[model samples]
Target: MLVVYTTTLFMISLLIIDYSTYVLEYPHSFKYNMVKNK
Candidate 1:
């Protein structure tokens, strides 16, 4: 149970890091896409 929790937390952290990097690298594009989707 502990191992599973740790793995899930790690995956979530990786996703957050990746998402932040993407937003930082393409802020305008990300905002544009969000507006378009809405």
Candidate 2:
């Protein structure tokens, strides 16, 4: 049971980190593009 719980927690955190990276990078890329065009 403990092993299963830890594995689930690790997977959840990995997903969260991936989501955070994508979310943070998306706006940064858009902003960078806007600045470049200006």
- Candidate number achieving the greatest lDDT relative to the actual structure: 2
- The digit string of per-residue lDDT tens for model 2 on 6-29 reads 999999999999999999999999
- Where model 1 places Cα greater than 4 Å from the true spot, the runs are 28-38
lDDT of every model, 2 decimals: 0.94, 0.99
Could you tell me every candidate's TM-score relative to the true structure? Answer: 0.69, 0.82
lDDT minimum window of 10 residues, candidate 1: 22-31
RMSD of each predicted structure: 6.2, 1.0
Clashing pairs in 1: none
lDDT of candidate model 2 versus the reference: 0.99
Error of 2 at 2 (Å): 0.7
lDDT of 1 by residue, 1-38 (tens): 99999999999999999999887889888888999999
